[model samples]
Target: MMYNATQKVISLSGGREIVIETGKLAKQADGSVVVKQGDTMLLATVVAAKEAKPDCDFMPLQVDYKEKYAACGRYPGGFLKREARPNDSEILVARLIDRALRLLFPADYHAEVYVTVNLISADKDIQPDALAGLAASAALAVSDIPFGGPISEVRVARIDGQFVINPTFSQMEHVDLDLIVAGTLDNIMMVEGEMKEVSEEVMLEAIKFAHEEIKKQCAAQVELSKELGKDVKRTYCHETNDEELRQLVIRETYDKAYAIARGASSKHERMDAFDALEAEFASRYTEEELVEKLPLIKKYFHDDVLKKAMRNMILDEGIRLDGRKTDEIRPIWCEVGYLPAAHGSAIFTRGETQSLTTVTLGTKLDEKQIDEVLVQGSEQFVLHYNFPPFSTGEAKAARGLSRREIGHGNLAWRALKPMVPVGEENPYAVRVVSDILESNGSSSMATVCAGTLALMDSGLKMKKPVSGIAMGLISDSATGKYAILSDILGDEDHLGDMDFKVAGTRDGITATQMDIKVDGLSYEVLAKALEQAKRGRMHIMDKITETIAEPRADFRPFVPRIVQMVIPSEFIGAVIGPGGKVIQEIQKATGTTITITEADNKGYVDIFSQDKDGLDAAYARIKGIVAIPEVGEIYKGKIKSIVSFGAFVEILPGKDALLHISEIDHRRFETMEQTGLKEGQEIEVKLIGVDPKTNKLKLSRKALIPKPQKA
Candidate 1:
């Protein structure tokens, strides 16, 4: 059998080439493509249902990104020894692809589309995530699906002040700005990344640089698609449109919806008014005639009338739905130390959204362990964001962690991670949990604010307070008119052309996420949005600082305290002992927890205890274990055993020496019994000398007795 495959190669800076090929693997799928760069390869397949599900007025696109353990030549961790549920990293990648692809589908095409991108091969240098989006888009291009894109994604890193596309894992370490940008040949659709307090101008430049590369990759896909004769997409009637009903619904409801939007009422109030207007329109039809007509009525009123009214209201008038002018922020209130029992706690409320966040400090054992195929490590600073049903006034049951939760939490984590102190500056593992008690829009931004306050309340000295704001854009391509709304409401986000979130400190941006829903979104608009976001962030920062200017002077009294010490690497084994016997005994005796790790030729020891005395005792014990004894210093010793020639005395927790009878009181004794020293006896002794040949300590009991006061 013979297979026909079409391939396209895109050459990147530094002479790196990415090969995208189709028709050679997973041929039975509706669309399949293999994207390869160096040893890294991803197999992306997309399949769409032949017909849309009944009453499915929205596109149901599910994107799954998985990495096979075999890709990296490693077995999966755990008892199952197989891949389980998608990890946070995988979900984040899938979200990037889904956000870009979901925007390119035809608005009328409501088919159930599934896109799967799997990392079949791995390379340490080439990150597979940046290629996954390209692979998925290419698969769609080669299929007979009604997709409006042959988009591609690229990761741009500013290393040594130079923009490099799809940088290696090693190069990422030095990057001050790291962004994954996805776009079609004409416009940028999605961007998400973290920065090291970089300026907005620098970030904008990086995005522009990434788009040039994405355009090249997208063009290659178009070329490949034409070669395979798959340029023409299959047509399907997904919607039974009642043109008369659509126009009638718009004609009747558009004015009412516009009035409600212009009223600038609260979120629920506005929602109620819109719902009532739609219900009033449906009241004209009989219940028997409503079943089929109701769906279209709601769809038309929502997708066309309400959206248009909101966008036009914002574009025509500077007033937003909430009555604020463009670039204006919502009201904000903040409180710290709201929870007494928590190590740190805060409540941040901006407009209708509210976040209750708490901070917990723990030992090294509390760090989050990450065991993904390409990433393996532990995180000292962990942030979790949760959005419950009641947050949005929804009556549905709260299920397990959703991809939105992971993506939002990761964004907050990135925004705050750069400020969380690490290493010797902070000795405890930090965990920040933000629960959205109430939400309208930008719950993730609320989380960032709450997390910052909670962390500071916990007495963790953050480098600087970070604040985030979500910006919305309403633009008319024909009129060249746009309005950039600051601190947008949830409704604005749903109806706007862009949802752009920027998080940072007073100095510069730290993290950002943007998704463009419309074409012809210019860089100028983004620049303006970023600037407006910065101002909104600063306004929010004022509220944050008013609540708490800085981290507490110290941790609460009840909070467990951790003391860190560093010792020579050679002493690590002695401190741990055989089977961890030494460390366990120390912990049990001192009522503390001890952890020891070696790095850079030194052992880092941390002792954690709620009781100060216990913490001090554990510190002293470990200090003694690693302490090197001097020949002339005196030490309190414990008699361990006695022999005819001498008694074995422990000078430290684990250090022992021989105390000869002659050195006991400067007198010679025939037997050890004459010295009156017994096991378990404690006495003071002087470390007089060390035997060079034996490398043993020699302790003298009478060396400090004025030596023959006989003098």
Candidate 2:
């Protein structure tokens, strides 16, 4: 079949080529586009689900990241030799693309949209992720997906704190932050990034810069869509008596919902209040023909009541349901070194929110094995966040890691990575797990604080101890109504205008995450939030310090120790061979990293250990770049060899000496029997003579038999 389409190609200033084509590809799917930047290519296709996934509160959107290996000139590895499980990088990339799309999708619509990005090439210059987001937006634009899309994605980087858009891979290594912002021209949907503790003002400015670029891309998408847009076919939203039932619920439970939202100060009370309201609303539905039908009525009632109560409290009363000023924060308490078995352990609690973090130290062998872009090897440190059903005081099925868990873990990981040591800098392989015992607000930030304390407890020498705080801003009320609260409770976050989490050392910021439902605010509000966060963080820091401010004097007994050393570049090959043959030997013998890096004609090898003895053994094993000590030093020795010229003797560990013929005996003897020395013999010898220049040993058996000859 033939298709009518319009295409545009733009060569950006940095040799980045953008190919925009629509209507030709994915004619059946809702929207699809092939975005090519230099040689890197990605095919982003968007398809909306015909019907909503039942009872799913969240928008059901699926984003997949597929890497075409032929693009990288390599075939997949494994028996299947195909992509199977989603690699961490793929999951993260798909998530990155999903965040941008989620915000643009219609809010009330539950129909699902799936965005799949397939990498056709891996250009050494162009980045795949940047192009993926751009193409996905284009696909959505041309296809009749029921999305408020046409929003664009751009990467904002800071080099020496100066922001740059779409930096190359080489330039990225020097950047302090990698920020990706995806949003419409007028409103922002989402932002995710890693910062090197840049100030809030700088981060805000960078976001602004990214958003401005997004505007231009959005316009481009609009033009492209107009040229080749298709009619979007949308299924009717789930058939429900939403409006009528919602009104019935509001009329029946307005007071109860308000009471649940506004009156409850604690988690348990809130649950009780919500249950009471649910029970009260269920009374009206008892007479339904079908008993199961009551469930639907209660569900509708539960949602409407919750929504009204919260919205009324925020909009009308101007009082947060949590009873805190818009700028007020919940109380905070912190403790470190709480776990005896861990290298480090800490518990940070803000109001009802809590996270218990434990740090385990390990040998380089403990480094997490990962297969991902940017980190194709092992990682020295890993931060894992876990949310159990019990954490919310609920009885629910639990087993696998949900996407929410992975996303939260990753968020905490990115927030704390900058403060972690790098290279051969730290001797410990750190793995921290943050267990969210309870969460109301900013539990991830609490994890950061707890992780820091746990690291210190393990005896790691950090450049500085770090702490984190969740800053909250309530939007309503012009004057005294707005509050910049520190250590916000969960209710504060739900009711507040924004959630701004900042973490870093006392000297400066290390990491931050900001999300708000309200319109983007000016720099002044952000600045104030940051200032307040610091105060809140410091207060928590003091409490942590009181228990164990610094890393312990020693690592936990279960934790491992690591030692590093340098080897000659020439020795690198001797230590590691083709396909890691030699390195494997070292690992089998010493049980350590034995990692090698060469620069400026020099090689460095880092070794790790769990005990002093292991550390010593690893050192001896890899330090074998040179032969053992020289042959001759007068001392007791073992006869390892018995040659006619003399005998090869053991002088020291891994060292052998050849006893000269003349030194073997005072009388001239041509036969080995005349020397009366057997191969298994051990004896003391005198160093009557030796050749230091040639590393040859001359042992005197007859001369040392004692002065009888002289007598």
Count backbone overlaps in model 2: 8
lDDT of 1 at 74: 94
Q: On residues 1-711, what C-alpha lDDT tens digit does candidate 1 reach at each position?
A: 598877899998778899998889999899999999999999999999999998998989999999999998999999999999999999999999999999789988998999999999999777999999999999999999989998999999999999999999988889999999999999999999999999999999999999999989999988888888889999899888899999999888898888998998998898899889999999999999998899989889988899999888888878788889988888889998889999999999999999999999999999999998988888999999999999999999999999999999999999998999988788899999999999998999999999999988988889999999999999998999999888889988998899999999999999999999999998988998888888889999999999998989999655799989999999999999999999999999999989887789999999999988999998989889999999899999999998889999999989999998888986778988788889999999999988999999999988878755564
Best-fitting candidate, scored by lDDT? 1
Q: Which candidate number would show the highest TM-score if scored against the true structure?
A: 1
Ten contiguous residues minimizing lDDT sum, candidate 2: 624-633
Clashing pairs in 2: 144-232, 326-483, 327-483, 327-484, 327-485, 328-485, 440-490, 456-551
lDDT of 1 at 606: 93
lDDT of 1 at 206: 96
Provide the TM-score for each candidate, comma-separated. 0.98, 0.86
* lDDT score for residue 227 of model 1: 86
**Residue 606 deviation, candidate 1, in Å?**
0.5
